[model samples]
Target: MLSEGWAKVYITVEGDSGDIERCCEKKDSHMEDLSLQYVNLEESENLERHRTEGFSSSKALVVRRGAPFRVSLQLEDRTFHPKTDFLRIKVMLGSLYVIIPVTSSKKVSSSSWNAYIDPEGLNLQSPSIFICSPASASVGCYRFQLCVFTQESQKAYAIGKFILLCNPWCREDAVYVPFEDQREEYVQNDSGLLFMGTPMNLVSRPWSFDQYEPGVLEACLNLLQVSPWHQKNTRLDYLNRNNPVYISRVVSAMINSEDDLGVLKGNWSDDFKQGVHPSMWTGSGDILKQWAQSGYSPVKYGQCWVFAAVMCTVMRVLGIPCRVVTNFNSAHDTNANLVIEEYYTETGQKLNVSKDSIWNFHVWVECYMTRRDLGPGMDGWQVLDPTPQERSGGEFCCGPAPVKAIKDRRIDLLYDIPFVYAEVNADVLSVIVSKGRVISYSKDTEKVGSLILTKAIGFPIHQSITGDYKHIKSPTSSLTSRRSTMSGDSTLSRAGSSNGVSVSLTLDRAQVAGEPVCFTVKVINRQNVAKKMKVHFNAQAKEYNHGPSDAFWETHGVIKLAPMEAKVVHQQILPAEYAHVLGDNLINLAVVVEDMDSQERVLASEEFNIASPHLTVQVADSIVPNKVQTASVSFTNPFSHPVSGVLTVAGAGLIQGKVNFRVLSLCPGGRMEQHITFVPSMVGTKMLQASLSLTNISSTIRGFKMVSVHGA
Candidate 1:
């Protein structure tokens, strides 16, 4: 409570390690440092008694990292008299973060307050905060304080203050951060927070889309940013050419900046990460039919390229941006068919293709999405070539294996499908591959070879669709950014072959200790003929503990594999085996892949790991619905514990409010349902959100989703 014409405001900063400071407008400033760490403002200088004619101070001083930065003013209380409808506080964070407007635990009953920043505003690049006091006679010269905290942090970090003055000039000063005209686009007056849209209608696809017009050929430049081909081409050719003519033609035909669709780099989006499968694009359109009939993988001449392009195209067309990636799995034994050969072995012997030594090029795509559904339009990836069967009867079949040593392994050449192949080996003669016949190699293999072409292959459509999608052009290009498995670039000379060969295994880490030990095995093939090999592994422990080891490391399954193929095995060490090895423990691991024809040895190895478990945190059911919305906000602990902490909700005009709850005391691992009743005066269609932390567990962070009121 204060005099008729006087108002008070509070300003605070949490975790102000760097001493974030803000200058106040009023010459006389009052500073209250609640943290007790230090107080910068003297108590007597609290109010700037003399008001400038306009009642405006220089820009309000504020420390960047300081919390609760505030100011108070002396005014005629008559200005805040009756008919006052609402009290509001505006908040803004200089940087980007999800801000939550929270009120002080100490309740002020006489005045009502509404919030500005809503849940939708949380999605903005950076948003401000707003608190509105319900306009009423009790508002008098009340102190309206604004508290803001990041979504990641439960506690308030920055605080601001203002006086609820009844005078008109005083009210204008509170809303000064953003001009009144811009408020519609950036914030709501009642809550002083941003107005983010609804969850189903979240804002994405940059605002630039709104300004796009057909007249601006430069709009075509948008392709340059979304499409990788444009990015590279604009760099190599159009870096200086901003001419309208060039933009029109390039944008009109949508000619990617790099190569044609059939010969593009990769299809995966830039956001793709490990463990996720790449997307595939296939359609029955006329353009796709023409491209697929050309002995290509429907999109490009190379399977890897086609896979990459299709993956990328699907993601882009669906509004997810992506980029092509290129890398060589030199230490990867899982993908040998993609290896490029390297000539001149360690012994100075010309390299050859054997079942045990080979490498081939490969390609795959990746992406990231708000949700885990596959594909843009609920339709996920459909198969064009259903029931695809690999060429049988050889060291290389459906799995990783030598290319030349296998009969009918080349899907492009073996089928009546138009195919292309280049011989990089100087010793490779003419290669004649026929179905059911071992491929015969001659020195003339350097000559360009074309296989029969298969056309009009049909695919079965998957009934299950996931994300939203729109039909665009069928993928008709190949992404070539991935490295060639066969690292060999040597030009072909006279034909000659050697039997000398060598193999090596590279592990992800030489040392690792944990409950689950995952590592990769890199197998290099240094031979000529397609070599069929077997990799065998065994672990040696001190006391021969065998419970979990028998279940996980038993050698019952066959390890038959291709040359240069690497495999990453995730091994979870069981609790029983922990006693056998202590510090610097040694264990033997072996890999053995044999040459199918000669039945000769290829690889053997040893590896080890230090085993231990680490504690981790995770949040469950992040999207919880607000079932009952009355006097008290409530939620059930989906987990098996007595979750105990504060639950919060913001949005749809709730700025400064309070919620009371009765404990349901549900049994452990049981459901306890209850109903909530809020003051009927505060009902609306806007989303009401709340979060209550009931568990002390570090991983107990919760998210309230699908929030709705009882009547609304």
Candidate 2:
């Protein structure tokens, strides 16, 4: 039972009179001044022996709402005994506060603090306490004051002011059921995903969200447009506010392009023309902190991988279960026609007419939730894409598309299952056009969405679930009958070949900025007599949309091949030759072979990208909020001529304003370094993203450094 002195302090204030009375009472109390210390339970086994001051002066103690918290405290004055002394905790938020009387035993009461005080310690004057936040406690930051009152002294002393932040997680949110062995992995561990390059069977790189980092929950609340500390609305507002629709709407809007703070733009050429690697990113918390600190500006440049990774972080921080999945050979079926068409000229030069395109790989996030909105079997995993490519309900976002609906080809379902269905199952048509007429074309069903993958829970291995979505047979309805027939027949009849002569082309590897582009063309002659053929080769650089930009090199030659002979024609392009024509590091190369006597032609073409050097920024591993820090930006020229550019450095809490540096003449292969200094305004994970844009080259290279900041 609480003593009378502590009981008199537990008053429930409601109106203006209560506020006036509490203020007058605080001023009248002649309490002794004593320093309060917090015990470091994580670092020390004995709570009484290891203790530090509780305040912003040290790292904040973070815990989720409803989670048990243990804190051992010691008073500066050894005259106070824990057994006889009464302690009261006051939690203050703005003008309102809650008073809970600390007790030696756990007692059930609305105002009673259910805590256990251990008096038997190395220092008998110090006491270790166990406290638990009520399940209904709102998520936010609060200032708490602990005071001790002695019956002999008949006075209460103010010990210290501590900051307590309630995270967004509750027991109801921990409903994610993983496999028996993976139960601990999904709930307590972080997942991983690979990015940047072509999809491979390699293990995904590990990433930690570190949701416990200070200000993470607040930043997440900001993303959801919820006030962290103040509660104008109750938990029951809008079906508990944590419902699927509310969560989806918040996440969708936060990641979509309509809001720049969404962090990613689907347009690849705008920012990635110079070269940005998604794999280089550290983790989601780093990206989010950087965005939050930058005042919600889109983080320089990001593609599908970056969007998915950051979305995963936001969802996990909000107590939602999330995982990043990658689809290899993903099809962007812009028209919802269930077919992506590619056009090529007679000489195999790819035409830029078709809006459809196939990405080497595309990544997106899957969130686990029970969808009462859709009802029934749709209550499992829902797909959500942060990349703003398609518009959903006039907004640039996609999903909460139910995975079950996508697998069953239920395109009529809510959200954007149709778009996702095309991404994983669309047939790719390769068409050859000459003189405004279609000459030859072939459709390949297996090319797009070859393998759908996600990391195995608790394991560093690739898990293939391609068969799950691919098991459904082609739709036989009248609407899709013609298109389905075209796909089946096109596979049986290979286009671009006639008279038993076949031509094939292959690139040595993806071209780099300073390296030569080399490819081989193979032609088989099945005729009994010698044959004369004309070979036409062409190379051009084009934008990601397949729009032709410049024709770099073209040549024609005649070759005589004997009967039953197979000839391989090799072409090598020097760096100096294509450097001036390649605008965005992407090139479309084509090769064609013609049998002059029969007027038959065979064509082959390929598209590849060249890599550019990245602008690197280096800063300290850990930064202190409100303290000045210096960062260095390094850039290397990978071109033949001198490049002039502007380097811009910006961050949210790390810098006050954007910092810029101008380079007049950075010679090719020359390295340049610049330094910038700024003070951080808030504590948590911070990002310093820098970009260098060439004035003459129309290109931009970007890089970022993520650092943790301790509260001052």
Score each candidate by Cα lDDT: 0.25, 0.60
| lDDT for position 433 in model 2 | 79
lDDT of 1: 0.25
For residues 1-712, could you state the per-residue lDDT of candidate 1 as single tens digits?
A: 5433232333444346222222111222232221111112111222222111111221222111101222222212122111211122433322212222333332333233334322342422222222333322111112222332121111122232222221111222211222332221111111111101111111110001110111111222233333333555634333322221122222212222122333122232323343221211111111123333442222322233233333333222212222222211101221233223222211112223332221121222222211112212211111111101122222111211112212222333221111111111212222322342323232322111101111011111111110111111223211111001111122122212224223333333323232333333444445443455454444443211111112124231234334544333334334335333432233434334344466444332322334221111121222223432333333444433343444433332222242424344544444333333332222221223343333343221212222222333
Q: Put down candidate 2 lDDT per residue, 301-343, tens digits, no spaces.
A: 6667777877776666554567778876688998889999888
Per-model TM-score, in order, reads 0.21, 0.62
* Per-candidate clash tally: 157, 2
Cα lDDT of candidate 2 equals 0.60
